[model samples]
Target: MSKDNFLKGAAILSIAGFLVKILGAVYRIPLANMIGDTGIGYYQTAYPIYTLMFALSTAGIPVAIAKLVSEKNSIGDYRGAQRVFRISFIGLLIGGVLTSSFVFFGAKFIVGKLENTNAYYALIALAPALLFTPIMSAFRGYFQGRQDMTPTAISQVIEQIARVGIGLALVAVLLNLDKGLPMAAGGASFGASAGGFFGSLVIIYIYMKRRKKIRKQIRRSEKFEKEDTSKIIRNILIIAIPITIGASVVPLFGAIDVAIVMRRLQDIGYTQKEASGLYGQLTGMAQTLINFPQVFSVAIGASLVPAISTAFARKNFSEIKKTATSGIRVTLLIGLPAAMGLFILAEPIIKLLYFSNPLEVQESAGSILKVLSFSVIFLTLVQSLTAILQGMGKAFIPVRNLIIGALAKVVIVYVLTGIPGIGVKGAAISTIIAYVIASFLNLRAVRKYAKIRFNLMDIFLKPVLSVAIMSIVVAITYNIFEGFIGLKLATVVSIGFGGISYLFALLLTSTITSKDFELLPGGTKLSNKLKKIGLLRR
Candidate 1:
């Protein structure tokens, strides 16, 4: 695929990602109110286990298959590519089934074993989504590797829509049926399984439709070469397994934290209920809020994997370096200002969105949000760098970094949670500290081991400047809107204005140049489309 194709893919995926994230946040705000922090805690508490297993089963394989398939196809090796796809899909299908069973049937034991019992039923609801998520992801990787963003992007939106729509409806219905808040929240979270089922079906339809098109292309051409199916499977697994393991560590740390930190909190002085509420705030509220900006980072990072892998496979070191630098730069460009905005506006944001809920621990939610905000920059950087290293095929380095971070987190949480004043703040501190360690380790490894170096100035300065401008604009807009609009509406409007103004300022200042725009997925096509639609200045 050409650079233009990359840009087009990025643009579509980025927009889809933005929509999904926005819808996700909007859905969560009410859902948080519906479930309260305690319910959210229960919901999130079970999620890490689900997330890790999901990652182990399918995370690395899809990208590996996509990279391998794309590379093989580029070299006109259709037989090898076809074999790789089939094997990876079957492996994921099996893994998905086992995970779903383990999560669903074992929910009672898992919840009973947990320090917090409030989250047990939520785990039950979430199990099916765990089963189907990998299957959907596999198809996404297949299409993405083929350099088609339409299906992948569309499916993400459809999944979120299904999730938000079904989740809200179900939660309301369950609440009315006199289910407790936590149980209702669990019901909401469980809707992900339904969404996953539907989303996977949508992608399957796309794949079936495209499969015929590809077959026709193959029949008309004689350029394709076949390979042994077993060899292809082995090669795909070799590349995919390490990546899957590495990709899962950060989330695994999070899941382990729910078990470890919640238990520690109870051991120190808190009641089971209080501890559950606190854990919920940290994971469900603060972490979820922090995740909003991460959507951009993740979407960009996901696109970068294939982009960098393609470049590296062809030995275009400079292009690989450029993509790496751009990916990190773009992450910070979006993340820093978001972190700052959250830090400054944490209380209002949290209160405005979640305060109406009757959850027991709402008063202290602001502190939770603030503590988590500090980790966003580090988390975003770590995420982007992890993807870059993986793309360079130095996937083990990220795993090592995560191991170090996880070890640090365990030690820090143990000491800090026992202290007189810290309590759940210890977990937040551990997360930030771990992310710092992981981010630096990842960057260093990429430089030392991969012989990859990003331009420091390009990565840091332009993005920082862009964020500064955005922050200033946001602050001004928030103040201007405060008197006219109610608190929540004012907050929302100010944020909307801030985002638009920031992008505008970035373009005006040339922080993100025309070339940068052109290099983005569908930059030229989007620009032209915008111009045609009169959204861009002539």
Candidate 2:
């Protein structure tokens, strides 16, 4: 894909990701309030296993397939590309079944090891999604590799819809029936299974409908080279394994948190319920908000994989530079404001979302969120640069950096959480530091390999200035509106003003240029209109 098409693909995925995250926030906030932190603690404890499994089963191989398929398409080897998909799909299928079975059957043992036996049912409920998730991911990788993000995007949104609806329904029903927290959490967990099943069906149908067209392209290919399945598997694994390990680092930290944080909190003299509540506040509430911006990072990172891969395969150095730069720019443009916004409005935002909870719970969660907000920029940087490196066939560099960061997190959380009153807040601090180290290392890696010097004025200064301007408006807007309107409405309106002002600042300072706009779908026309309206420069 060309640079413009790359942006368009990112746009499609970002929109879908945005929807998914919103739904996720919708799901988690209600679930947290409904179950309270202790119930959410059980859910969150069980969740890390699903996330880690997800990273293992779905993350790496699909990216590997996308890169490989993009490479194959560059050389007009359509047959080899399809073979890569098939082989990878079958392997993922077997792995998913085995992995999900392990989780389902081993739910008690797994939750016991994590020290949250309350999550046993939740673990069992989520295990089935592992089977379906890999299937959905296989098709998603196939489509993404071919540079068609539509199917992946559409499927994700549809799946999230199902997940939210069913998850909420099950949780509500289970809770209403006076079933135990474990069962309620399990009901919520099963929503993922339902969503995955539906999502798999959607993507599979899309593939079937497009199979004829795919074959038509295959037959018209300038070259058809059939590779041995063994070789294709090797190529896919070579690319996938490191990526999977790297992707699992963050989720692995979840397991780490489950293992370390609860024990540390209890050792520091908090009651079991209090510790669970604090854990829930940290993971279920703070982490849920942090994940909102991560969706965009993930969307951009996904697009970058194929963009850089296709460009690298064709030896198009300039395209690589352009794509990498855009990734960085977009990362900054979005990341800066997201992190800043969260920092500025942490308490209000949390209170607005979790108003059903006691004031102390809301306050505690907001404080944790404030600390976690800065991690957004660092995590986005790590994600963006990691994608660049992975696209350049240096996937392991990121995995190494992230692992190093994860280790540091373990030491930091252990020490910090051991302190009286530090507890889960310390866990939040550990997360930020881990991302900072990982992102710094990633940036260094990108510099050493790609030699793409980021222009400070374009990428850093512009975003910083835009966010500085935005921060002023947001702080003022929230403060001014809070007294006049109610708290939630004020928070919402301030957020609305923040978005408007941030865009205005971008346009006003020309931080987002006509060239940048041209990279987006219909961006040229939008640019022309902006120029006509005196909001854009030549």
Give lDDT per model, in order.
Answer: 0.79, 0.87
**Per-residue lDDT of candidate 1, residues 1-538 (tens digit):** 8889887887798889889889987776777788777777787878788778788888888888789878867876665566677778888888889988998898888877778777887788888897788889888887887888899898999998998889889888988999886678688877788789889989999988888877765555445546667777778788887877776887777876876878888888888887888887888788778878777678767777887888889988878777777677777777787888887677768878787655346557788777878798999898889888878888788789889999999999888877758888898899999999999998887677446766656677767777777778777877888889876787888788778877776655555643344445567777676557545552
Candidate number achieving the greatest TM-score relative to the actual structure: 2
Cα deviation at 23, candidate 2, in Å, is 2.7
Error of 1 at 32 (Å): 0.2
- The most accurate candidate by lDDT is 2
- Per-residue CA lDDT of model 2 for 433-505, tens digit only, reads 9989998998888877776777889888988999999999999999999999978999999999999999999
For model 1, which pairs clash? Answer: 7-520, 7-521, 7-522, 8-521, 8-522, 41-280
After superposition, the stretches of candidate 1 with alpha carbons farther than 4 Å from their true spots are 1-15, 67-85, 141-149, 206-232, 299-330, 358-360, 387-392, 446-538
In model 2, the runs with Cα more than 4 Å from the true position are: 1-18, 63-89, 139-154, 203-232, 302-326, 452-458, 518-522
TM-score of each: 0.82, 0.86
